[model samples]
Target: MTLTERLNQDMKTAMKEKDKLTLSVLRMVRSALKNKEIELKRPLDEEEALGVVSKELKQRKDSLHEFEQAGREDLAQKTRDEIAVLKQYLPEQLTEEELRQIVRETVAETGASSKADMGKVMKAIMPKVKGRADGKRVNRMVQEELQ
Candidate 1:
């Protein structure tokens, strides 16, 4: 099933199962998806839906960090729960080793021998990894490989 269909089904299930946390997270995601559709004046394709999910995940992660820094465990935990829910919609994440391998290959493919070539390497690699790897993690790995 498409991501949108799966999310709608899961939202209904969450409602029936009385899963408050899941229900709330799913509702937020649905709202984001709806907003994105309206913004584009069309329904999202799978990649666009994944982009929305990733954006939501990134926001939650940033909030989680801030909440933890502010010593608010309750808010941090809620953000973590939201992140877990959002993760269900992402492509399976690449392991560090796999990400490193891809970075190495990308470096070679782009002849990226130093930090100056970072942008070129990243531009070439992002499409391959897309939703599968965290951009920051990929960037770190690329820097390490280059050095």
Candidate 2:
């Protein structure tokens, strides 16, 4: 099934099971998906849905950090729960070694010789690693390789 269909089914199950945390997180995801569809005037494909999920997860992580900084453990915990639920939709993440290999390949493919070519390398690599690796981690790897 498509990601949207699967999410809808899970929403129903969550509602039936009275899983408030899961249901709330799922609803937020649904809203984000719906908003994107409305904005783009089309249904999202799996890749697009994955992108949305990644964006939401990043937002949750940032919010969790802010909450913690503000000494709001309860809110941070809620964001953590949401992040856990959202992560279920993402593909398996890349390992550090695998990420380094891909980064090396991308640098070679793009002929990126120095830190000055970081953008070129990143542009060539991000799409290949999308949803599979974190951007900051990839950036660090690229920098380390170039330097």
| Model 2: per-residue Cα lDDT over 28-139, one tens digit each | 9999999999999998889999999999998998899899999999999888889899999999999999999999999999999999999999999999989999899999
C-alpha lDDT score of every prediction, in listed order: 0.91, 0.94
Model 1 residue pairs with clashes = none
User: Per-residue lDDT of 77-127 in model 1, one digit per residue for the tens?
Assistant: 888888998999999999888888889889999988889998999999998
Task: State TM-scores per candidate.
Answer: 0.95, 0.97
Global CA lDDT of candidate 1, please? Answer: 0.91
lDDT, model 2, position 100: 99
Model 1: per-residue Cα lDDT at residue 49: 90
Cα RMSDs of all predictions?
Answer: 1.0, 0.8
Worst 10 residues of 1 by lDDT: 133-142
Please list the residue runs of candidate 2 whose C-alpha ends up more than 4 Å from where it truly belongs after superposition.
Answer: none
